[model samples]
Structure formats: structure tokens, C-alpha cells
Target: MLINLWYVAEWSKTVKDKPVKAKVLGQNLVLFRDLEGNVKCTADVCLHRGGSLSNGWVNKKRDCVVCPYHGWEYNGEGKCTKIPSEGDDFKVPPRFKVDAYPVEERYGMIWVFMGDLDEKDRYPIPPLPEYDDPNFRGLETEFTWQAEASRVVENGIDIAHASFVHPVFGYPDTAEDNYIESIEKHEEWAVSHNVMYPPQLKGGFLGWRKLIRKDKQPTVVHPGWYLNGMTVKIQIDLRKDWKIVMFDANTPVDEHTTRTFAWQFRSFMKSPLFDKGSLKRLSTILHEDAQIVEASQPYYLPETLANEVSVKSDKFMSTFRMARRRCIEELGWQIDLDKRDSYNGKKVLTIPSPGRKEALAEGRGWVFETMPLVAPVKTPTEKKDFEKQVDELTVDQLNSKDNVIG
Candidate 1:
């Protein structure tokens, strides 16, 4: 998993008076709302006796998480304010603190930055304007996949698979007719417009929905991906006025498990009465997708394309891979899972949050070692060559008219 990006920790409503436990990028974290109703997140491991802060309760009087083991109180900034054994007159040392992450609430989800990058250098969270717009009716749902988060993201944006996997969206016979219309690329995100022929909407009351589109009607869809939150957004234009948009934030609970927090918004279905069918169809689509994604080979995304073959239809997905590759190779954010697994239960390592980074800069020692990262590609020549390869992947190679893709 890569660091220095925002990941959804939990639903905003879930974190109330009590502390909640969250796992992201394989590190355990504790989240709780303060007296002001602002959510705060910190490393779950307590500095005192290695206790779990999440297992404790929120001390409302002090606006802190009270460690159940020793009653050590940690505030929003993670400084240990009180130790019951030490008594009220004793002052806790400044160094007695835990790693605290930056947290924010948007679109009803709690997002935490799982790295040490300052606010200026961090990628902004993807905006979902539809979530707040009154013109759209929104429904929220969540799913967990026993697969890599990257795989889940790629599957969400893989338009070609809709034909074979989701009969409600496309037909296997019409898969060949699907084509990408245009693509827009950015350093941290990419968007693509595509055209597909799918069956008409089914199961509306009295078959009224069949009039929305004909069987095998051509539809336009725009799929986009953002590095922050590992988010995938797909907007389908059913017609000029009617549209369906899905925004999914896929979180890597670990290297092997991904939890998807999804929201579906529709322009035509404005009534709450239609929610049952809409949700049922959404559930069905997710189940269909899980069947294929979980069984894919290699388990995780490949470091390079050498072991895999990409067709023209995979060009959009390739952009995501290459963007993630840059973060791993040049930015050096990808975690060294192999090295981490070697430590196993012998050691406790946490992701370096901004607080930890600042403390270390000031010569304050920490109790746990930061998680190891994959070594970045060293040397200016190698960096240039890697950039050239990325350009080729995006321009010359992927843009080729041939059916084969590099």
C-alpha cells in the first residue's frame, strides 16, 4: 500500500462519543470525536504499557481517550495528558505521545491522511458535488472484498468487464462495440469517456422503465480515478436528463482485503419509494463483480506489465497502474510488505504520520519504528528513464491503433 494519501477510515456517523478502531494500510488506528464534535485519529497503540486506546472510553471532561490499562489520557494531538498512577500533580513529559494523523469529514465519511506529508504537498480528496446537490437522489452502500484494493479499483473502472460480468449493464455479444471516446490525465488522477451498448433498464414498476432506453441502446459513461482515497467514479448518461453516477472510495484494510464505501446517485429516481429496487440492483452488481475480482490470479497488482497482457480496452486501467507505479518508484511511498511480514509479531511498526515526522525532526524519540518502504529507484539517469517509460506507456504505446497494448 502507498502512503501520504487520504483514506476513508470510517463513516462519520459511526464515530460518536466512544472511540472506534480502524485499520488502513495495515496499521491500527483509534478514532473518536472530541467535545466540539470534531473527529480525531491517532495510533491505536498506547505509549504506556502498550495498551489499546480503542478499547478504552473517551474522557469527556478532558476531551481525551482514556487508556483502559492505566487510565493514561491522550488528547486530540496525541499528547499523554494524564496518568492515573502518576497522580494529578505530576506533569507528563512532552515526549510521551503517539502518532496522530490529520482527519477530516466530507460526504459523510471520515478521511485520514496515512502519511507524513504536509497539507500543501498532499493530494486533495476527490470532490463529489452530486453528494450535496439537491437535484440528485443518493443512496449509500458498502462492500468488502477479499482482494487487493488496487484490484478492486481497477475492476470498478474496467468498462469492458461490465459486458460479461453485469448483464444489467452490458451484454457479452456487444462487448466489441464498447469503445473509449476520450481521456484526460493528471499527475494524481485520470478520467476517460467511453461508449457502450447495454440492455434497457429492467424491473421498474409496470415495466415503465423500459421506455427510458431501448434494448442494446448506446450509452455514454465517464470513469475517473483519484490517488487519494483510492477512489473510482463512474457517471452513466442514460439519456439527456436521466443519469446514474457511482462514487466509490476503496480502502485497503490490509494488503489482501479492501472495503468499498459507495454512493449511488440518480437524477431521475427522486422518490424514496424506488430505493428498494435501486439498492437491490446495486447489491447484485457488487456481488457479480466480487465473484470475478476475488478469483483473479497474482492476488495483488503486478509491479510491471511484463507478466500480463493488456489490450486496447485496458488503456484506462493502465493509466492507474502507471500512476501508482510512479508513487512506488519515484516518490517511494509503497510499503515493503515482505519486510514488514518478516517482523511479524516480534515488533510493532506504524505508518509515519505528520505528527511523528515533526516529533522525529525535533529529536523526540518514538516507541515504535515506522513501517519500512520499498526502496525508490536511485540515480538521475534511472529516474529519467522511468519517466520516459511512463510517457511511452501513456502516449506512444497505449495510444497505438493496434489491438495489442504494452
Candidate 2:
């Protein structure tokens, strides 16, 4: 069940008339934009003796990609347009075609579908709340590292690791007990949440100064396909001045290696803090995460093992893992527990979006619809009873097979 969906390959603006090579779901692809302004993605390997299409050049006039080897040309639809050695009257072999994936451009990123053509539109890339918001300012950066894609994604959701792994950006003392606030499912996308954090600083010199204050706002976590890679979106609201920070990350290249494209968005783009100093600070913070993430790679663990005791504030990690597992399973890629443990398996699929219904229909049903709403079950009596029951349960019971698991 290789569910087909779009994946963000690169910033739409990044691909010009020049060809760019990318990999999606383990397949090498060549992308380019023609004079007609349409973006095209095709197998980088030409069917004609397996030559690399990326090694060729783009013919803007004919809106085609020309293979460097022997001068074979392919149109945007991947149809053979010309063969240098053959006359125009010569019939082209059907096998002469190159593989083409469906592509869509949005939020400055070019998205390509890696699954079945019939289901292309069934799963749309997750929407970016900050993309069109005038109040938000966006900054982009690229990071190349020797690490698996799963490790990077897990790091993004692991709030606890932030304290030690990222001393500067991670505020352990101010860490809030985040719970899965809610999950919203759409025809093309899904969204989940961790506990909300207040804007007021609870610790640190900044906290003492009270320079920046925000309401207790929930952190939105969204993981889906964009371009030719996987993307994770985290949104936090700084209530005052309509300030917001949205972290948009994508893995254009995934293997034992990964390339991440990230952007920080805020309403105030002109402030000096955000201009030069803030950008540097943000880079440092990302670098911190990258270092730890890369280091943590060799010792990656499964989400099932991450179910150890969690404080009230540790709710986000659990909720995020559940949502991630759901997304992965929906995409028809199984979670190989053994491989995940070994750190050398397909831990995630390449589809930009997973068809919610199709994914849920495979097994466990859609938790979003079947799972009881627990956010509102916070009455004093209920809370006490729930905590008491969990406390009273034996270690075995707490870790029992019957317990609900992701």
C-alpha cells in the first residue's frame, strides 16, 4: 500500500531553468522549471541506458529536459520528444519514457507526489498558517548532516532532550506539562498538539526582566509530506504584537544522510533583534539540535520504549509520537521495530501527505474518530481518580500489554 502523496522537493523559487537533482522516497529525481513557469520532476536516471537526466540540460523553448547522454529529450509529461540519432518519423519506444511524479507549488516550496497517480489529490500537503499571514516574517536556512531522517524528526518532538541537548533554547525549568490537546484530520492533512506554554518567562535572566511575555499558548505539531521530503511544522504564539514563530522543516535528501530546510517566521521582520542577531541566535539553536540529533543517531530507540513514566509536562512527547505513528502507518509503511532499534531501516514513508481514511482503514481504525476526548475529562474528581489508579497500578500493570499504546 504505497499510498501516493505529494512531497515538498525544494523552494519553488529555488528551481530555476537549471536542473536540480533530488531524491524522493529513495528514488532519484531531477527537477526543473520551464519557460511556461511549470515545474517538472522526473526520474533522474534516463531509461535510455540509465543515463542521468540531471547531467543533461533544460530546453526552455520546448519545455523539455534533454539527457546529456546521446541527446534524448523528454517533455514535462516525461514523454520522449526527440532522439538525436533518429529521424522525427522514427517511432519512439514506449519504454523510452522517464518516470514523472505529480507536483504542486505552495508556500514557496515545490511538492511532488510519490505514490499512485489516482490518489495524488487525496492527500494534500499540510497548510502553513504563517505563509500568508502578514504578521509573520519568514527566514530560511539549510543544514546538511550525516544522520537518519527519523532521528531528526524524533528530536523535533522530544521536548525533554531540549534541556540538555540545547541548553540555550531549551528552558527545562519552564517546561510545561503538555498533553495532546486535540487532533484535527482533513482530507489532505492532519494536525496534532502538545501542551500550551505561557509567553511569560518562568526562569532565566530574561524571565526576571519580563521583556517578552506571551499567553499560555499551545504548541502545534504537524508532520507531513512537502516537496520531495518530510516536513514538520511547529507553531507558537507570542500573544502580544501578533508575534509568532513557525518552524518549517523538510528533509529533501534522506538516507544515512539528511538535508533539512528550515524557516523561522514572525510578524516583526524589521526588528534589529530578528534582523542580524536573532538570525545568528536561531542558527546557533538549530546547530545545537543538529549536533545532538546527529550524535543521538547511533543510539536511536523506538517510540514503544519511550513510554516510560512521564511528568504532567511530558505529555507532548507522547502525543507527538502517537500522531507520528499514525501518520507513518497511514502511508502504508510499516514501522520495523527491529530495524528502528538497529537504526538502519525505513522508519518513515516519503509521501508528502497520508490519506487519513485509507491509512486508518488498514488497522486500529482512525484514533482521531474512535478515541474518546480526554481533554475535557479534567474534573478534580476525575483527575484524582485517574492519577490514583495509575499510581496504584503495579509496575507490570502500568506496563501491561492491555494498556492502550500507540
Candidate 3:
């Protein structure tokens, strides 16, 4: 996993008032929502002791998270507010805080910058405009594959794979003829505008023969790949009234593990039934790809072109490989390929997340120790400042002529 890019940590719905564990770019972190409704991402280990913060809970006012081991409190900004070990009056040093990655919640998934903060904005999570379309219903999906993040990302933008991996919309014969009409390459991403001809659509589960205008409409697809964790595949049908857009955000759990967060949007899927059906179909299709990907040789993507074979149809994948090579060579964002792993008896390369270094640095950081289990004390504050604000909003809502509450 390369640094300086946003990776999906987890789904927003999974994170509640209690802290939850999420691994991205090989670093274990915790996520939770404060009373203000803002999501907070912090190093899982407590700064004082090595207690995992995910095993902790929120404070009385829901202002900060309290550690289970020593009751060290950290706010949404990742600053230690209260250290129970020291008296409440003892002010915690500024440096006595866990590392907090820049995070934002977008399209139902929490994204975090696992690299330098300066580059966070340079590579914001790829946008999914289809999710906001008023005419389209949402089809959300997620899957975990035992594959490297790089391989997971590359396969997402590889059009050739759909022919063989996903037989519903494509065939093996056309997989070799997947010619790239054009490719736009940038420093951080690559866009492939290609053509896909789904041979005579026979009646099946999708029933594309009747849904489409013609027996086989040449679909033009533009797949954009951001080397980090986001990809978008947009298919435009000229004769049809609707379009299909698939968005994916792939996060790395470890060197050989990847968790994918995805969504399928259709201009015609306005009903909830279609939304559910599309999501179900998408799950099956992705698992098919996973089966092929897990058995893939040389788990890690090869940096050198000579290490693997390539063809003209591999234009997009090739560009990603070149850009990935630059990240490994010039950007100093690489992994140690010599670390022995218990899986498969072969060493898998693993990159050191900068987030982990900052978490373990001076001033102490999140705890990594497995201390004795302890329960958190919940002392909900009696109608306080936040409740007062809520009361004011409630009054304003009641006084308003419109029935809608603000």
C-alpha cells in the first residue's frame, strides 16, 4: 500500500457511538462519531498504555473517546483531553496524543489519508456523482479479497477481465479483442475510454435482450483509475435512456489482504427492487473475480514490465504498472519484500505506513498491548451545553411555518 492516498477504512453505518476497528494500508485504526455527528479516525492503541481504543467507549457528553485500560480521553481532533492516571487538573501535554489521519466520509464510506497530510487534498477520494442523481436508486456493495491492494485496484480498471471473469455481460472470445481506443494518463491516475460489444444478448437473469434497444448495443465505457483506492467505471448507451456507473474504493487490510467498498448505480433502476437486485448481482460478479485473483501468481504486482507479459489490450493496466513503479522507486513509498510470512511460506512485501510511525513516536501514542479487559463508565451529562443547543433548534423547528425539522 502506497502512502499519500485516501483508502476506504469502513462503511459509515458500521461506525456508531462506540469505537470500531478498521485497517487501511496495513495500519489498524479506530473510527467513531462524536456527539456533533462528525466522524473521528484515530490510532487504535491508547497513548498512555497499549490498550486498544476500539475496546473503549465515548465520554458522558460524547465529546471524546475514553481508553478502556487507563481512561485516557481523546477528542475528535485526536488530542488527549483527560488522563485519569494523572488528576483531571493535570493538563496533558500537547504531544501526548495518538496519530490521527485526515479523514472524510463520502458516499457511505469513510476515507482516510494514509500518507503525508500535504498530499491529502492532491488526491481526494474519487467522486461518485451518480450517487447524488435524483433519478437513480442506490445499489451498495462491499467485498474482501485475499489479494494485494495494487492487484485489486488494477483489476477494477481492467476491461479485459470482464470478458472472462464476468461471463454474463461478456465472453472469452472478445476478451482478446478488447482494444483500447484511447488512454489519458496523468501523474496519479489513468483513464481508459474503450468499447465493449456484448455479443447477442440471450435471455437470462438480466434480460438485457428486452431491456436494451437493440440486440447488441455497442457500449462505450470510460474507466478511471486512481492508484490509491478509488475507481469509477461509467458505461454510456447511446440508444438506451439510462447509463450504468460502478464506483469502487479498495482498502488494504494487509500486504495480501484487500477490502473493497463498492456501489452500482443505474439511471433506470428507480425502484427499490431493482436496487436490491443489482446489488445482489454485483456481489456474485465480484466474487467470481476474487476467485481468479486469489490464485494469481506473484501476489505482489511486478514493477518491471519484463517480469510479466503484456499486450495492446493491456494499455490501461500497463500505464498503472508504470505509475506504480514510479511510486515505488522515485516516491520512496515501497515495502520490505524480505519479511517472512506464515501464509504460503513465501515472503510478501509490506510497506511501513507513515501513520504507524507517527503513532509510535515521541510523546507516546495509541496502545498496542493486550491488557486485561475493562468496561467503560458511561456518565451521560444532565442537560448541558449540547442539549441546550438541541433545545434551541427544537424550538426553532416548532415555531417554523413548515413542518420539516431543521
- Which tens-of-lDDT digit does each residue in 1-406 have in candidate 3? 5666778898889988788898876667888888888888877767665677889898988878888998988887678899876897998876665667777889888887765445434465676777787866677788888898778777778888888887665778767555567777666676778778666544536675455544335777778777657454545453556777777777778777888888877787477855665676688878888988888878877655434555456656655665665555555555433332333223221222344356556444543321111122233223232122211233334334431111
What would the per-residue lDDT of candidate 2 be over residues 1-406, giving only the tens digit for each residue?
1225456677887788788888754556889888878898876766566677888899758488889888888877676788879988888764455556677888787778765446534455666777777667677777766676656665665555644665443455656443445444332233444444444434434454234543444444333322224555665444446454545555535446666767777675445444565567667766887787777624443445344544433333334444344444443333333433443332222232233334444652321221111122112223232222122233454344533223
As for TM-score, the candidate ahead, 1 or 2, is: 1
| Residue 74 in model 1: lDDT | 96
Q: Model 2: which ten-residue window has the lowest total lDDT? A: 369-378
TM-score for each of the candidates: 0.94, 0.70, 0.80
Clashes of each: 0, 15, 7
Pick the winner on lDDT between candidates 2 and 3. 3
Q: Cα deviation in Å at residue 4, candidate 1?
A: 0.7
What does candidate 1's lDDT look like per residue over 1-406, in tens digits? 9999999999999998899999999999999999889999999988967889999999968389999998899998888999889889998998888889999899999999999999999999999999999999999999999999999999999999999999988989888999888777677788889999999877787998889889988899999999899999999999997889999999999998999999999999699998888899999999999999999999988767667677678888877887788788778999999999999888889999887888888898776899999988933224333333232244446645441232
lDDT of every predicted structure (CA atoms): 0.88, 0.55, 0.67
**How does residue 234 of candidate 2 score in lDDT?**
62
